[model samples]
Target: MDPNEPIESADSTPESTTNKPQVPPIPTDGTPKKKYVRAVGPNLKKLLYVVFALLALLGANSGYLASIIAMQWYTGETFENFFYFCMFLGHVALGLLLIVPFIVFGVIHMRNAAGRRNRRAVNVGYALFAVSVAVLISGLLLVRAGGFDLKAPTVRSTVYWIHVACPLVAGWLYWLHRLAGPRIKWKVGISYGTVVGATIVGMV
Candidate 1:
């Protein structure tokens, strides 16, 4: 209150004047802070289920053709018909429709599993994916070599065996993959039913 004794301004007090606890500046380097998102959304999971179901159908058809029909009756007409069937079922239909989505979503799922430290799932998923890719490539090679009408007998035989073998391996890996992940009982049932039905239809 003494005029000669200068009163401290309210704002000049240490508490009032103290700088706010500075927020640490976000790092400007290109490395972004890791952010975890939901690995598979509900919609994506459903789509993956559909993809898996179609894969089951294709697997059944191919398995039936190779094991029961092709091995038993390797006739020219049968081979030609099977080749056309594959072209329609595999190359034209499911391959064109679902292959990209399957690969993309499968990789994403695997990466998410890896991030979540689900090592077994990641490993099995990767193995399944690799085998599936091998099967696809070998099938293409087999077709290119004239399917059952093999022009290059050696190459066709080798590719034929590889195409056949990879799927059998993939079937096992697929089951393992299913075991490792959460089970959708209904989807599994439907897939199995589809496989059985497709196999029966293939027989006819």
Candidate 2:
């Protein structure tokens, strides 16, 4: 009615009457930042699950070995027995302990990848770990079955040396698993776990 006068705006002409900054639309490319894939590939998923399970089992076993060795070391009189047993068990058990976590982590890494790169070192690590466990267990079982007569000429220091060495090598290989990630940091974690395992086994 008052075209000659300045028109006073209604209480609400439009809520968005003023110009607003427009947000850029998201790109159609499906790639999302830090988007984790479901990792549904049957084979890769199975591998990841199996690897995780093995890590858990191995960790428990290492704990058992460590306990036995520590107990044996506590009861025994001769430091020589303690030393030998501790060294062997500590190395083995600790090595396993160190490795289990990394292996589990590696499985996670693999599954998350939406694709797996070179896993050769990691695979080698698993094999070596299994072999180490078997060797140590067999050696100890042999000694125990023979009435703890590890002092026999046939079961010489060389046998003991091998017992210690098997797991040590495995430990080192497991350490390589850390390299599976971007960089390699050879801190004392796996090495220490191996020592603990060897210590425990030795006591037993």
Candidate 3:
């Protein structure tokens, strides 16, 4: 060592090699924290199925009423005028009820229904839903405009054909929906079956 240089102390140590205080890693970037999102779950999906099937049954009942009018026109038969009016009111109420779950389930499944496997089926389903909604609105409007005259050989009104035809096609579309849709629980299946049987029985 040079004579002018200070001697190093025996206790001197480098501070850089000491164990660092481990920092708890934190996200300091400008991105907003992600909120917790509940996943699309089975129970909710099943409930939607139940609601959809029930809506179809209600729609079927409305169509059956239209058939009664058609038959009266065909056979020169007549129904209780007041009874037809009551049925029309019930159909309107059911249509209003159907609208609620349709919107709610559509929103709930928006993110989950993005697969391509059932695209065609889903497309058909959406079309049927639109037609059904149109039928509901038009039927309500026409009935309000005095559309339910149960004359001999049926007057064949626009709303009558719409109500009848849409349901006829929608029946097959519902079958298509089932063929291409996801597999569900037996309970859901049972409920759907029950509603469908009831709808058919009503028509008969």
TM-score, predicted candidate 1 vs. hidden true structure: 0.62
Off by over 4 Å in 2: 1-116, 142-152, 155-158, 182-204
lDDT of 3 by residue, 1-204 (tens): 699997779887656645667678777896877654332467667767767666756755665675676678988978637766776677777776766776666556544554445688658767766765666665554544456543433544665677667767766776776676656456966786687667645644
TM-score, cand. 2: 0.34
Q: Each model's TM-score, in the order given? A: 0.62, 0.34, 0.54
- The sequence of per-residue lDDT tens digits that candidate 1 reaches over residues 1-204 is 677997778667575447667679889897988887666878778878888777766755555555545644765344446655754456436544556777778777776667767678668888998988887667655554334545777978898788768877987897787786667487767878776776656765
Clashing pairs in 3: 73-153, 73-154
> What are the lDDT scores of the predictions, listed in order?
0.70, 0.56, 0.64
- Global lDDT for candidate 1? 0.70
Question: All candidates: CA RMSD in angstroms?
Answer: 8.6, 10.9, 10.2
Tell me the spans in candidate 3 whose CA falls farther than 4 Å from its real position.
Answer: 1-40, 46-50, 56-60, 143-156, 182-204
Alpha-carbon error at 132 in model 2, in Å? 2.6
